[model samples]
Target chain A: MPRKTTIIGILGILLYIVGCYDGLLVAPADRFMGDIQRIMYVHVPCAWNTLVCFTISLVAALGWLLSGARARAEGRAWKWDELLEATTEIGVVLGAFLVVQGMLWAKPTWGVYWTWDPRLTTVAVMELMFVAVLALRGFVDEPVRRATWSAVVTLVAYVNVPLVYFSVKWWASLHQVQSSPSTVDPAMVLPLRINAFAVLFMSIGLMGLRTQLARRQRQALLGESDSDSTASSGGAA
Target chain B: MTGVMQGHFDTVLWVYGLTTAGLLGYFATLLLRLRASKAPTSGQTRVSAQNPEKTS
Candidate 1:
């Protein structure tokens, strides 16, 4: 790992620990939800970071498509393709965890393991779409073709991300509207903000590391292909 | 902490425990993968020639 990423990750972990202390021990329990509301420290941050990761994935997808087209025309390397793969993989993992965390929180608050409410339903759809993106990449053998197809698919699927965010406001649902500093108590807000930043920094570090790994894997695969082509050509000669 | 609301500490503990475990596990896996990718291997030079992005 890069020194900068390592520093950021360590700082993120420290901040998260402090935030957990504040949230789990220091913050007063809610009048209504009592200790159950403490789940927000984890649940809300996961929800927010999941959206953030998918948004990064969407941007990376666009980058891949545009850079790929340019690479074909100008003979440039396709780093964006590697980035798209990395972000999509990270996003899918985070999205799945987001759903699990939501379910955990929901069980305590809503008294159910699952609900087909708008927000929940939309997020589920979004998660499935990204999973399909990963599966789609696996099906395509050609790197360029896979990159282009997945990029287009990612853009198409990203339409649901905003839908998931606005579902609570657009339609009547069990999920609460977006939480803000104004909506939550001052004491509660501090820990929430701390945790959010911590998670964000940690996510950035993870994505950087993952992207590096993806690039290395792609390089290794390309090397094998090159060697095979050279061997076949040498045999013909 | 007078008037501190009580009850459901178990719920709080579970939430924090699970979240910490999940995130930490994920981060650790990524770090391990990164280390594996960085290890020098016989195929490393061939790959470096083909894709010169230099992930370092």
Candidate 2:
């Protein structure tokens, strides 16, 4: 995993450099928004990846709950708890980053940092729910209970993601509808694609590192040896 | 010309500022973590050197 992360890191850096050069040096600015259109390359990708992270987290939480029940019934003993923790941690970090980036994008495009738009408001609520899940984990000391409850929160909070995505479409709003990839000019779209790939790899890499760190912390709480062979269960509290 | 130019100016500044800040924040976090990971190893080395007699 460490080797894989290193390789991903190297690739991420190389791609990002190439991407920046393409965005700044090679591509021409938009006639409409001019230099500001360049913001889409970064802003749009962050938004997409943030949604992607949340969706993965929701699926992982559901998988954990189902697998845990099966493990208990079959007496197979799975480590779904660790999986849940890792997924939630990744979800929260990416979710937070998404909002920060969105606010940055919004302040310019909308003429305000925040304006009670449905999509923005719903996404903020979803991000808060994620924080609540983490707080719940912190308050619960018992491993099994923490994992089970957090999984539940993650699963429930996931319903808001679609609401956030569809809010602009369903109501009057300042937020722009998603750009059609087919119609995007090649010069503009190329950097956007590269940025998306870079951010995705970077997000995954950070999540992988966080998962391992969370696992380590869990082991320490359980009073286990520092060896990698130590079993990982609920350790968030 | 003035009205159209003003319209784009604030938006352009806002986008650039926010995106730069976001990217910087992420980069700062990575650096902080890297620093933290190194601290323990460096501390252990210092401890061992300072108290070689305590080494078992």
Candidate 3:
């Protein structure tokens, strides 16, 4: 685990350095966008990472729910539920940042911070769903119950991600369709492709770190309870 | 710079500023929760009583 973390961390740092330097310095300014288009380097990566994180959360949520159901029948739950919770929590954090950055990018390019365009609207919905999942976890006291419900919600809400991606194509929207991978020139593609990889690596690193922190907290909390139980029983005896 | 340039720069700064603050707030919350989770229980069952879901 430590090795995986270190490798991902080093790769992310290198990729981020190359991506930021090349994107901000070597890439050409847009004909229409001027210097403001530099926002794309950061904004686009955040957007991509959000989607990736959300998809991972959705998969974890599915595992949580399915495994939990089996565990309920068998009267045992494995330790994997903690992993689901950790991933979903990290995804929400990254997803929230993505939305904020996307809006920031919009203020300059789209002339308003927000629009009711399909892509933005769908992403907004997705963000809210994440919020709901977190709120649900806080509401329930039973770990199993919380895990089951949050997992269910996470899986259901994940359907919005693809909708958000396709929204620009499916309907009229202010946000520009993907220009780098498909229609744009080779010059634009270089930075974009590299940046995408950089963000993916960074996302993995962040997710791993966040999940580790979460599991540590879970262990600490459970350990405290076990100690308290033992102490009280001894006193009673 | 001209007024338009100043205006655009102001918007850019605000966007980055708010985002930085938001991220900081999130990290702080996570750290605080983590710390609370590790606090010793002092042979008390209040935590589980207070947070029953966490217990069973």
Candidate 4:
């Protein structure tokens, strides 16, 4: 809702367009996979952004817990809780994008749409775990309890995040190990990096908007609760 | 073996199309939720249950 957030989000959309153009037209096609390799530009960026968003959620969870008690008394804890919800939602969206993109690429390159590859499997697990955290939030009604429980569950789900990154290296799999400038063609790296930054900008913007929405919703709930209590007390008087 | 040698333009198109559409859809929903939250209502409690963000 903030001007800065909108600017960054629109800027990200612009960058995504440019990045896609570069990947689709400027970057050379893979000799093996041909034009299908272009999917890597968006696919790799989504993967990186998904991890980044989840990492933000992890940090937000820690913030909520570490600043507990005193922060709660000071009424400062909701900021962290709001952030946790925001980033977790965005992370889920990006992770879903990452999986679907991976599947689309796999269909042509690996002869199938779905595979039990190590990295792929771990990524799926990671996405599901974070999604469960979101569902946990929906089930809990109390503000403090929802924040506390989701934070704890986030901590548990975060264990698989590292595994997702390292799964390819630690196991024999059809998926390639992490890509680097040294490993990938130099030309491909530019658009890939562009999309990476684009997605990061977009994530930050979306997170800010989401956190703002949470704050407004909480404020409305608290207002309603206050009025209800006041009305009951007035009736008793 | 020859799977990688076939036409894959459609696959690439689908990847980009789906991701772009998904992210945009999410952004639109967030914007709508924000607007809904800002909207003043008489039975304010119903906002959470019916609204999209549902961060209650």
Candidate 5:
């Protein structure tokens, strides 16, 4: 691992410990939900990072599609493609957890493990869409075609991201509106803010590692193609 | 802090415990995949040719 990533990984661990301290012990409990409300510390941060990862995937998808033809042909454009893969995979993982966390939080407050509410439904659909993107990428045999198809799928799937965010407001639902500094108690916001950055740093470090793996796999695949073509050319000569 | 509130702290524990497990589990999976990709195999030579893996 790079020194910078190592530093970030260390920083993330430290911040997570501090954030847990504040969130679990220091912050006052909500009068309504009481201590169970503390779940928001982890639940909310997972939600935030889920959206962030998908947004990053959308940008990476755009990068892969918009790069010049020469860049694509020379295999230089695989960076964006691999990044798209990494972020999409990470987003799907985070989104799955977000749903479970929301369910856990909801059971105590809403009195049900789940409902067909707008927010929860949209998030479920969004997670499944990104999961399909990962599955399709694995199914394709050709690298360029796999990258292109998944990128296009990512673009289409991103349409649901905004829907997921707006679902709570667009219609009556059990889920609360977005949390903010103004809305939450001053003491509560401190831990929320800390954990948000903690999750962000950890996600970044993970993305870095995941992207490297994607690149390495692509390189191996492409190298096989190169070797095959080279042998054919030599035989012809 | 209230007696009733203390009764439901389990909800908080559920999310905290699950989220920690999820994050750590994903990180472990990622590291294992990366390690698998680095296995000594025919593809290792090809991957090294594109851009050298960080030696430092």
Candidate 6:
């Protein structure tokens, strides 16, 4: 990992701690939900970060597809493949976090551990789709083939992300509509925004480290293939 | 339901506890994978030395 990303990660963690303190102690309890409303601080941030990570994955997937096509046409590098792999993995982790946090919030607010609410169901589907993309990577042996297929699948799966976001608006569900600075209390907004930015920075930092790891893994695989081919040729000679 | 206090302190604690644990666990796993990737294992060193062009 890069020194800059590590610094950003540390800063993000510090901000998150401050935001948690403010959310838990400083912000007044909600009139309806009381102290349980504090769950919004972490839950909302996880939800937003999950979407952001998936968005990054979508953009990287598109980059990979386009660059891959261009590489075939003009014989160039496919650096975006590394990015696609990294972002998808990071997105999966964030998506998993989102589900767990949402579940925790739902149990108290909705009186059940889970329900088939449209928003919840849509988010679950989106998470599973991206997870399938990760699984796809492991099964493919050829580098180019794996990258191409994963990118295409990701593009198809990305259709669910927007649906996850708009599900509350599009359908009547137990989940609340998207909260904004206007809808939420001004005092609550500060900690929520702070945690949002904290998670955002942390996601970027994790993605950077993951992308580097993916690059290294790819290089190692290529080196192994190179040695294998050379050995075969030497044996023939 | 409006303007009624629902003191669910247990819920708040559970949410915070679970979220913190999940985030920390994920971060630890990522760090471990990164460390393993960076460590100069014998196989990786041999591969890197063999394929000079791939390193850069």
Best by lDDT: 4
Which residue segments of model 2 deviate by more than 4 Å?
A69-79, A225-237, B2-56
lDDT of 5 by residue, A1-237 (tens): 656766786687788889988998899988777898888888888889999999999999999889777666555677788899989988888888888988887876778989999998999999999999999998996777787899999999999999999998899988899886778999899999999999888888888888878866765564534223221112211
User: Residue A186 in model 6: shift from native, Å?
Assistant: 0.5
- Which digits, one per residue and each the tens of the lDDT, describe model 4 over residues A27-77? 988878889999999988888889988998999999988874656655566
CAPRI verdict on model 4?
acceptable
Sorted on DockQ, best first, the list reads 6, 5, 1, 4, 2, 3
Candidate 6 is scored at a TM of 0.85
Ranking by lDDT: 4, 5, 6, 1, 2, 3
Worst 10 residues of 6 chain A by lDDT: A228-237
Judging by DockQ against the true structure, name the best candidate.
6
Cand. 4 TM to true fold: 0.87
Question: For model 1, how does the per-residue alpha-carbon lDDT over A1-237 read when each residue is reduced to its tens digit?
Answer: 467866787788898999999998899889877887888887787778888888887887887665533354432335566677777777777677778777877886788979999999999999999999989989986666777788899999899999998999999999999886778999899999989888877877777787677656654545533223221112211
Cα lDDT over the full model 4: 0.83
Writing each residue's lDDT as its tens digit, candidate 3 over A1-237 gives 346854785697687668767766687766566556656665676678778777877777766556534454332332345556665666677677667777777877777878888888998898898778778878875555666787888888888889988999999988889655677656777777777787677656656556655555544534534333221112211
lDDT score at residue A188, model 4, on the 0-100 scale: 93
In angstroms, how far off is A28's CA in candidate 2? Answer: 2.6
lDDT of each: 0.76, 0.65, 0.65, 0.83, 0.81, 0.76
Off-target runs (Cα >4 Å) in candidate 3 are A68-80, A224-237, B1-56
lDDT per residue, candidate 2, A46-138, as tens digits?
677777877777776776677644453332222455556655666676667667657766665577878888878987898898888889989
Model 4: per-residue Cα lDDT over B1-56, one tens digit each: 74456567777888888988998899999989998885333455576557849534
Lowest-scoring 10 consecutive residues by lDDT in candidate 2 chain A? A228-237
Model 5 segments more than 4 A misplaced: A224-237, B1-6, B39-56
Off by over 4 Å in 4: A224-237, B1-6, B39-56
Q: Can you tell me the CAPRI class of model 2?
A: incorrect
